[model samples]
Target: MMKKITIVASMSIVLLTTACKTKDLKMKEDRKEFISNKKEVVYQVFTRLFGNTNTTNKPWGTIEENGVGKFNDFTDLALKEIKDLGVTYIWYTGVPHHALIRDYSAIGISNDDPEVVKGRAGSPYAVKDYYNVNPDLAVDPANRLAEFEALIARTHQAGLKLIIDIVPNHIARKYEGMNNPNGVRDFGADDDVTVESKRDNNFYYIPNTQFEIPDTDAPLNGEKNPLVDGSFKEFPAKWTGNGSRRAKPDRNDWYETVKVNYGIRPDGSKDFPELPAHFDKKSAQEHFDFWKDKDVPDSWKKFRDIALYWTDKGVDGFRYDMAEMVPYEFWSYMNAAIKVKNPSAFLLAEVYNPDEYRNYIRLGKMDYLYDKVETYDKLKDVIRGHSLPDGLSDIQHRMVDIEHHMLHFLDNHDEQRLASPEFAGTPEKGKPLMVVSTTISTSPTMIYFGQEVGESAAENAGFGTHSRTSIFDYVGVPAHQRWMNNGKFDGGQLSESEKSLREFYKRLLNFSLNSTALMGAFQELQSVNRDSSWGYDPGIYAFCRWSTTEKLIVVTNFSWLTTSTFELKIPSSIIRKWNLVDGTYELTDQLYQESKLTLNVTHGEGRIHVVIAPSESFIYKL
Candidate 1:
């Protein structure tokens, strides 16, 4: 009897060992699959302000007094520091040659009339030249393009892609492509200016009327230039960038820029060829083939060549400004060309209308769009204690089909700073908000230059007021300067709170980038926990992200004054999907790794008691 029992025990031991090896092999396969799916992290820096160390921050300051960051400022060390921050793409905002108030005539660049310029530095969207880099961004204005190319090489050397603005909807009032390639003509060079609208005209004209500068108190920088005399010479007034029809646009209008006519008549009818039926379902290569032999509008050919020019220069992608203002057909054509040239080119657009989101992605062939109207607005409401966290579930549900195409960001050049009183009154509130933004979906995440260091943007920088950083003025970003630390590119002068905030950003961003589960399936646990668990409140949010080999439970508390002690629950449906059974498991905080919690499962349902301090978040990995 003893010999028979030993044989049975030996057989059981072998079976258990086999099961262990099978489980290990499955885990390795799951990891390989997860690694194939990558989530991108973009770091946006205002090109003129990122490396500027001068803290003068004078309102309406000149580039000489306030100083400007050059292409050389993005040294190998600076690029390395940005890459170490877990950024995959570096968006060099305001890199293109735009209409600025500064004079660079020695390099054959024309001076822009200050009356038509936004501020001393001018708006980057008001692009003056498309074929050349901004002369103001070069140490040697004569070799500006070469300097920018060097920066591009350094960016690639640091193992990061580069993105620059491509403003397709409009151009500066004083448009001039001085460095246009041989045989390439300027935008309006071939236009018939006497007509109100033409299929091939680059701009719309209010025939027989001269352009008049809007009546304002003064030029944004206190009339520093002699040319700020309330006059800009245009033979026939063109339509304003915002589609104003009058000879004199309102002060609130986008007066600094003139609209580009994309074969759409003044009556809002398409004069260009429309896409064929069911073309949205076709591939980009198919679209490219369709337009290959077809005759397109002149403006179409111009912009396409411009985009191809930058693509040839090693620019990895573009952030198109006000893309929705242009026709969807143009994007289908333009994006198809870009994709054919560089199959991996990242195409991000600023499209706000939610109804047009799918059309832009499917037909326009765009990779991503700003989630401003839905996700951004809803998150801001939740952060301000004006709404509950449950609404995020509804948003996720609505966007499930295209969730991966929505790029999430808490701060950008266009938004109010998170640390400003106008936003959340403190940078600490960003902790929970950012935790949600980065990990809530499979979409890419973006971080503005000073967002990590809590730049309040309290300075009233001339044309732009307090709450948002000035894109139109030559000014120093104070918080970012401390991080620059006199070109060392380290946070040498950062305060304790600022340092902690940056570290929090670093931890969350890095984890979100490398975590395989974030790029996998996601399920919101908010509704389930609220219905079944105790200590649940509107201030708390919970979700589950899982892959074949990894599972994560994320929870955040937005309340600045109240601590949340809650029993977070993961429902049976998600448990079954995660292939989890009735058992006890250990969950550790992936962000801080400072705590370990026990998750007890029974009947396929899991529950864990969690204590989230005010404005804190946890990515508990199981």
Candidate 2:
């Protein structure tokens, strides 16, 4: 009876903490004036797969069969070539130590059970050690962290920022903090199993329960684990990463990982300090100041320390995985501490919920969110011929408030390749889309490695379906291997078509990288030109963008079968805004400057004739 009363008293103390004053939340209008500039090209490379030359792709293959890439593979010359693609930052995915099927038991790491790991290489999201680098990426396993540190130095030397993944939502089911620095405590090391929920407990436990291994009765990869004597035990089973409370989670569920607790009760009410209602209206530093003196939960502090430790290692930034799954307050707390360590840190996180976008940004302190579901999805629909060009206009209108804060990309680790059979089936089909995606807004643009030469990702990797490259298995990318040219880092072995495709990506990406208009002002001409021509196919779209010194008209034909010629009209409003008089101006295709076209202005309206081939786009500068 006394223990029950003590627990109740502690719960009351947690619920009775003072709330922040709402008056402090009303912020100055220039709240976003201090956001770090992120107008650079980010190239996301699944590091383990990027430079792997091995082509022996067998299902459920071992490291010796399907070889892994090392950190040294990112040679100085290789990085320079990527820079030639106009890349400013390189996000190295799967850098941290994660669970894998291989036996590193010789060294302190043990082979993870197949039932608890995703693929041969394992899912990168299931980090095993927060303080160590993946030994697979090192030339010498004993010096993996040193090799990664050298890579960081090399990336900075090549004038590119380095980005690594930080998965805050969960960790490997076999979560053990190996190689933790002094004073750093492993998660769940001090948990009290008697309680169902505690503010300081790192995980939520279904007390008095034991975890049941996922239902994998059928042999995985045609075999079952030799060590499986029908059970692997864990008393007081914790909730799975996907919020599955069942001890026996489904195979499709995130059974390989366990969720991290951040002071949210099982009923979803926050048990920690809440940011003031209008706190997002204030500057980022002010948000930081608000939490500077507050008592935060233990999980929040641990993640924050992890971030700071990396920032101290000269890491320029982090790309948070499934950021929205972790509470926004944790980001608000963690990112603030990161900024204090490195003010210009590039913090890009993946978020899908449109409704939570602003809160994740202004309150959660995320620098950029994935522009996937809105822009990327709509654009993909348009490319596959199921949707019209007007959807882009709708997206632009919807994202107007936070346009610059959304990062645009067609391919990432999680998405299908541009050339996969399930997608466009060829890299040529992505040219027009790439041009528009990179230039349509002022946000940062990201392109995956091998996306330029059209990596089909057709390898039947172990745990994942084909279409997207296997971040989980060690597999060589065919198209990219040609460009790697073994150790030459040149495209000497590339075929004519592959070389041409790379050239196209280079031209489009470089223009976006250097164009003043792209960063200055944007005005969509889609509405005006939608009905300008009689045969005006909805497959074509146009827009105008300008800076003081740069004024241009951009047009693209999304069709793969139709070569369309049309008179693209500039609305009277745009012509007047540009201060064009009743005269003719010479316009040249910046991409293919051998061609010149004429734009005639009459009665304050501009008329330009354009002939574009299938899957073609033009940047006409006046």
Candidate 3:
């Protein structure tokens, strides 16, 4: 009887040991997968604002300045500077050939105006040729590929990923060989009267339609329309004849950008009014359809080749500009092609809308989209003296809506800076605003150049380049000096408020990068009671993120002067003890064992950073 009992006991021990080994193996696999899925941070660079290699002849300076018309090489100095910023991805804006059309200037200016000529670096959105790199941005005339390769290599060596801008919607009006065959001229109204009148070009009349109405009612599609009334309705312009009148520059000139007609008919007989006269309507449709179907035209395939060319040279991804405007089918095909060439390649699309567009996530069109809704709405609330809402719930919904989709940024090239006095109350109030934006948001964040230094607006200037628009002050200085003086501008240096804001941002970024809680998925924690001040204010928000084995809590006080206090209900078995590393709060083991803890926070005192010690994050052992 004793021998039988011993045998049974031995069998049970062996079975338990085998189960333990299996669980360990599974955990290892899970860990590997989790690490692989970690998100990356991308920093955008306006190369022109970065520096000029030649001080005597600053290349790519305005044409009036007799600039050498080329960008500097990927200097080791520049790479080191960017590396110190603690970002994983570097997005180089406008690396391609600038628009060839020099005839018409942007709104609020004439073509011959000195400011117009000086500021005419050519809109990067208007692509002249996909194959050619802008000479101004190239380090060497002939070794463009080599220069690009070297840049990519250096970026990779510094533990950074490179993402170049890609404009897919429109090409330059005067591409060398691909000129507007339709005789459509930009400033043709001022040219020879007879010649301009005879041409049945689309550019002759700028549509003054309102966009308030749906696309179906708009005269020339909904693309070119003004906002009318409170709602977005489209009303035809007061112009008499089809090609008789020209609309004002800012209001309607952008309408001249023709829309592409995807082939819907089998015979391709549709006459797309947006097609340039030089292009055969049917042939253009066929061309567009070929690419849409993945049978890309050899000529058009150059765009894909450009992306692959850079990727093979070690670029990490492409920030596809105007991605939403392009046909969904094209991106679906493009993403597949990109993955085949480089699986690890990150594709970020500049999609502005929150609605699920045709190629959003289901088609695998892009890995990330510019999350405008979160930035403009949610982030706006916190800055406007409102409480930070239950962001975790919204984040959960967004995560479920688009799995593996990266959230883009609060500010980019097209928008004004959040730190600008226009948005964040004043320069004094900007620091707290910046903290909330960088830390509280769930998406992987992006930092525009000069943001870290808290560079505010210049006198009577907007946020980007023309006025306070510069990423850095690059006037009349050597490349090294300009590079070294990155965060400072010539006339507009960083203020005391700006310095503090910059340091705060740096710390927040480092903390986010280091914390698994901020980097990983978050779970919304339930409040103990709805009557509590924290729960009553829609702006006050709190959430907890936990790895399979570790847990973290994040709370934000969004009110201006109110103090918020709330109790946390944690599972006693999972959390043994937790400490707030921000060192503002004192939490004991009794609180954890009881599975309850009350948090008291002062409002508008900047984000009350609560950190847990002895962990990469403020962690509680489960």
lDDT (Cα atoms) of all candidates against the true structure? 0.85, 0.82, 0.44
C-alpha displacement of 506 in model 1, angstroms?
Answer: 1.0
Task: Tell me the TM-score of each prediction against the true structure.
Answer: 0.94, 0.93, 0.62
Q: Model 1: residues >4 Å from true position, as ranges? A: 1-36
The clash count of every prediction, one per candidate, is 0, 0, 18
**Tens digit of lDDT per residue, candidate 3, span 17-37?**
111111110112233332443
Error (Å) of candidate 2 at residue 220 is: 5.3
Q: How well does candidate 1 match the true structure in TM-score terms?
A: 0.94
Better of 1 and 3 by TM-score: 1
Clashes of 1: 0
Once fitted onto the true fold, the runs of candidate 2 whose alpha carbons sit more than 4 angstroms away are 1-38, 217-220, 223-226
lDDT of 2: 0.82
Inter-residue clash pairs, candidate 1: none
Model 1 residue 45 lDDT score: 93
- Candidate 2, residues 157-222, lDDT tens digits: the string is 999998899999889988778888899899999988777789999988889999888886343475
